[model samples]
Structure formats: structure tokens, C-alpha cells
Target: MTRFPLLAGAALLALATSASATSFVATTDTLGGLTANASESTSDISSSFDDDKIVRAARDDAASFVASNGAIRGAQLEAALRHIRQQAPQVQADDQQLARAILAL
Candidate 1:
């Protein structure tokens, strides 16, 4: 009974070590300069968004603003400004200036 437990523990340790040693591989085959399938496209887009979270967030906010404002010029500007601020809080002065410009238009 004790030997059975020892063997099980050894097997578990080996499994863990092997799993840790395994490497992940990523490859792509481009056909006419485009990705092969929708999965690849989604993966690529997701990776890009992950890298540029702030930019993506800003763009999303801008789109939301446009959507909520009923295509009105003033609402469009406010939305854009709000989005920029939300996405890039480090640029307060720039956000204010952009908000003014958008409101004016």
C-alpha cells in the first residue's frame, strides 16, 4: 500500500515536470497575403487589441459617443472627447483642447 502511494507521487511529479517543459508553438501560413481563416483573423485582432488597450478603448468610447448622440455634431464632439479622456487619462490638457474643438464643430 505504501509503495503504491510512492509510485503515484512519482508519476504525478513526472507529469508535472513534463508539462512544464513543453513549449507552445505558433505558426502562420499566409495565402495571398491574408490569413487563412476567421480564427486566425480573430486571434490576430485580439493580440493587437491586447497590445494597444488604451487606443482600442478610446476608439470604442468614440464610437459609443457617436451612437448615443443621434449623429448630432455637438454630441459627436462630446463623445469623442469623453472617449479620449477615458482611454488616455495622462493627456488631460490634450483632452480638454480636443473637447473644445469637437464642441465648436
Candidate 2:
């Protein structure tokens, strides 16, 4: 019985090793024998977003969420504020301010 379990474990280990050996490697166009020119374009990225617009959007979304849910607290509040920070790092508002805004509704 103990020997049977050991044999089964060895068989599974062998099968896993063999399966891993045949596993496919994922490749993209860059890795598939194609050369792509890498260029950094600063204009389009910065020009597309206006600072005021981003701040306004964040505030509006927060207000709407607070209104719908009545309030943001605990993990939900932390996640929402984190999202706002990630979306607009340059925005002047801090987590405390955002939390107050959410609760003010």
C-alpha cells in the first residue's frame, strides 16, 4: 500500500516533467523573427490629457460613487482613493481630502 502510493507519486512526477518539456512558449511579433523600431513619442501622451480634465473626471466619478453607495469606507474607500491617485498622480488632493469628499456626500 505504501509502495503503491510511492509508485503513483513517481509516475505523476514523471508525467509532469514530460508534459512540461512539451509545453509551448508564448511569442509576440517582436520575438517571432521580426524587428520593430522603438521610438519614444512624448507629444501625443502629454497632449492627450489636460490636467484639469483628469482632476474633474476623478472628482465626478468619486462623487457619483459616493452618491450611489451613500458612502465609501474601509477597503472600498482605500481602493477608490488609490485608483484616483494612480490615475492622476499630479493632482493636488491627498487621500484625506478625497475621503472627506466621499463622506461629505
Candidate 3:
């Protein structure tokens, strides 16, 4: 009946909204962790860590953060890009790799 259709539509909408909101939170957390790790790497580099080691560490941290949080989507990727630009300007290699991975997602 018409009531069935309306109920189904409402359920679908609710489910979609819930999924999107969860995705946003997960992506935000992942990106925030990446930004923090990048800042830490930058500090290590400034403190005389090898550039190659810093990049490697950052890449590993980013990968781990994404893996533990969830898969990134288009919107999440965009959020990460904006976050990187604002949060960690000095980040070069790690941020670049993270951006590429997010875009790939």
C-alpha cells in the first residue's frame, strides 16, 4: 500500500543519513590523526631525523590511520585535503602521499 512505500522511503533515508554521518566522523578522525602524525614527523625531521626515515614513518602512520578508521570516500578525501592544507603546511612527502591515497579512495 501507499503506507508501505512511505515507510520504506523513510527507512532508506534514515539509513543513508546514518551512514553518511558515520563516514564523516570516521574520516575526520582519520585525517586528524594523520595531521598529528605529520606534525610529529616534521618535528622529528627538524630535530635531525633522516628525511627518508621521516617520510617512511609518516607514510606508515597514514596508512595505519586509514586502515584502522575506515575506507575513505570522495567527500572524506576532500575533507582530508582541506585539513592538510590548513593543519600541516610544512608537511611535504607524507601529506602528498596521504592526499594521493585519499584521492585514490
Worst 10 residues of 1 by lDDT: 23-32
Q: Candidate 1, 73: how far from true, in Å? A: 7.4
What is the TM-score ranking, best to worst?
A: 3, 2, 1
**Which candidate would rank higher by lDDT, 1 or 2?**
2
Overall lDDT per candidate, in order of appearance? 0.46, 0.49, 0.56
* Weakest lDDT window of 10 consecutive positions for candidate 2: 35-44
Better of 1 and 2 by TM-score: 2
Q: Which pairs clash inside model 1?
A: none
Q: Each model's RMSD to truth, in Å? A: 14.9, 13.7, 14.5
How many pairs of residues collide in each model?
A: 0, 0, 0
lDDT of 2 by residue, 1-105 (tens): 799999999999999987776563334544543322211111222232335343334555555555666354455555656655676565555454554444333
Per-residue CA lDDT of model 3 for 1-105, tens digit only, reads 999999999999999999999999999999999888866655544443233332333444455456655343344444554555455566564544554443232
Model 1 agreement with the true structure over 1-105: per-residue lDDT tens digits: 899999999999999877666532122234433434533443433343344434343444344444565333344445545555565454424433342323322
The candidate maximizing lDDT is 3
Task: Give candidate 3 regions above 4 Å deviation.
Answer: 47-105
